[model samples]
Target: MKTAYEILDVSEQASDNEIKQAYLQKVKQYPPDHHHNLFQQIHGAYQTIKDQKSRLNYELFDYPEADFNILLDQALVSSEALTLSADSFDKLLRASIDDSIFQFSTTHKINNT
Candidate 1:
């Protein structure tokens, strides 16, 4: 479940040249003929950061931890206990847990490098 940045082995704030260099290095190691899956992932990651516009759009939508917390808190508060059955409540809880895990992973990835 690595982010594109992780796939490229580049920092979130990597410069264009740095990203290009990393992509090239990765391609050299995992050429498409022999490593099609890995090569595709590397290429996709490169495309994501290949231009300023695409990079800006990606960054703009990458939600912060606080935003996700706020959203989850709102969901809990907005839920009507009387309207949801036990099973529904369980499902909601599971979704909340999943969201939290996703948030944690994103945060971890950002902080790891």
Candidate 2:
């Protein structure tokens, strides 16, 4: 739900040139091969809010309490999916759980009671 500008230490009003420059700086500091999770998240955030046309489509809604560390990890997983090479295995795997998230949400907590 956050923007790339925030992650890259740049202003939201920054222009394309500014965004690109910021991205380059971050890449130099943390390349994907070295910082896989962070790089994946930065890539996702940049893609989501880079252009005005796409930004408008981005949506956020108030939810119950959320632990950001977990949410960020899930986002990172989704971002990694975007970078998969076409040569990657085409098979899809699906699993189901009783929880609403199908066991995906960071907020999911087991009640031992």
Candidate 3:
């Protein structure tokens, strides 16, 4: 899935005006009358991160789609020369899960406040 920034062809650091300009260009390239689906996507992306607050909200909540097979392959290749005991691997996985949960809770609390 393309991120709003990607769809708009704008950098993540783009200002509101820059994003608006990019959106206008995209609309011109894919006008609703001739390219309904592309126009809808562009419009949706624009709505998603058109302003500072909206961009922050989207960044806080948007989770990228992960390719598990690719991740697994990378992990296996990286660990090929080293062997992890069952207990060590289990500990590593548990630690990663714990870190992710902690981060989520922290972000949730900050957003709620």
RMSD values, in order shown: 13.4, 12.9, 12.2
lDDT tens readout by residue for model 1, 12-102 = 6566789899999999999999999889989988886675445543443552312344344435556775587889866775554446755
Give the C-alpha miss distance for residue 32 in model 1, angstroms: 0.2
Q: Across residues 1-113, which tens digit of lDDT does each residue of candidate 2 receive?
A: 55555786766455556767777788888899999999988777667556433332332222233333443344445447676554431221111122344344434455432
Residue 15, candidate 1: C-alpha displacement in angstroms: 0.7
lDDT of candidates 1 onward, in order? 0.68, 0.53, 0.71
Candidate 3 lDDT, 21-85, residue by residue in tens: 99999999999999999999999999987865455446545634433344334344445527777
Of candidate 3, the 10-residue stretch with the lowest lDDT total is 66-75
Ranking by lDDT: 3, 1, 2
| Alpha-carbon TM-score of each model against the true structure | 0.53, 0.46, 0.56
Better of 1 and 3 by lDDT: 3
Q: Which is the better candidate, 1 or 2, if ranked by TM-score?
A: 1
Q: Residue 71 CA error for candidate 3 (Å)?
A: 28
Q: Residue pairs in steric clash, candidate 3?
A: none
What local lDDT score does residue 3 receive in model 2, on the 0 to 100 scale? 51
**Evaluated with TM-score, which candidate comes out highest?**
3
Q: What's the best-to-worst order under TM-score?
A: 3, 1, 2
lDDT of 2 at 96: 14
Error of 2 at 85 (Å): 44
